[model samples]
Target: MSSPRRRADLFLDPADDPREGGPSLGDERATLTEFLRYQRLTLELKCSGLDAVALARRSVEPSTMSLLGLVRHMADVERGWFRRVMAGQDAPPYYRTDTDPDGDFDGAVPDPAVVADAWEVWRAECAFADRFVAGAPSLDVTGDDRGELTSLREVLVHMIEEYARHNGHADLLRERIDGRIGQ
Candidate 1:
């Protein structure tokens, strides 16, 4: 029997990723925020042009991750960090619960409405995160993350890291769905 197709074989050249204007070098705050924004856009770009069926496809056998699930998970991440932790607002999770911890991935059904709602919630959470960052007095501002003290800079950096990692998964997922890969 022939070997299964490898997703890694489908990667487009790294240079093919759409280049965003690099963050400003002079200002520290501007650099952090711009980099975070670029990472966020990268995730969006990876998911663009995909349909519900493609978005809901899991990765190779063991992992249940899907592009739609990533979007949903990120929405909850943004809300959890910015609204619930940083802002100290009592915001409920968008897709997960204590009992159904994997709801984001498990609930990613292949339907147009589900796809649309995933994007909607993701965008809303991103907007809210932007507002929270913009309104903060300074990067040094601290938040209580369940007993640990965290700063705005820490959260922003964490967010950038989070998006970067997930976007890599998105790259593979998109390529697996369609031989299209890259930025």
Candidate 2:
């Protein structure tokens, strides 16, 4: 009998080849925003149509890199850089601490409620970042922290990088989960 399809195979469209087109940007701000938006969409695409166990399944050994963990981590990262670092707030880290650095992944499980919570937090953070970026003049603006400066450009770029890195992990994890591969 045919094996179950891998989660990665289901998310990434292997039929679509990577393009070699030149970059398109009307301005730096627009370009950065677009890139960030694309990455976020890619992440969503990866997690789409997944059940609680599928989203939280650990495909690799000795690692806890589930799709749900990625969502939680991204949520924490968004709040950290935008709300805490950029806005200079005193909020605590989400789903992690010094004692449990891997809490986010460790806490990830095949629970429908947890999956819903992760998505909710991630969507809210995305909205917050979008609003902040829309009203900002430049990515190079400084926060209240002395010697600390950030631009909407830099944050967006970093977020893209972050998503790309995790997506790589997702690719393998998904592949292992079902043997689907390509995109």
Best by TM-score: 1
How well does candidate 2 score on lDDT at residue 29? 78
RMSD of 2: 4.9
- Candidate 2 clash total? 4
State TM-scores per candidate.
0.88, 0.82
Model 2, span 18-86: residue lDDT tens: 321225855887777777777777677667777999999986778888989999999888888778777
- Each model's C-alpha lDDT? 0.87, 0.77
For model 1, residues 2-66, the per-residue Cα lDDT tens digits are: 99976443233556655455756747678888888888888888888878998999997787799
Top candidate (lDDT): 1
Please give the lDDT score for candidate 2.
Answer: 0.77
- Root-mean-square deviation of each candidate, in angstroms? 4.0, 4.9
Lowest summed lDDT over 10 consecutive residues: which window, candidate 1?
A: 6-15
The list of candidate 2 runs beyond 4 A from truth reads 1-23, 144-147
Task: Name the regions of candidate 1 deviating beyond 4 angstroms.
Answer: 1-19
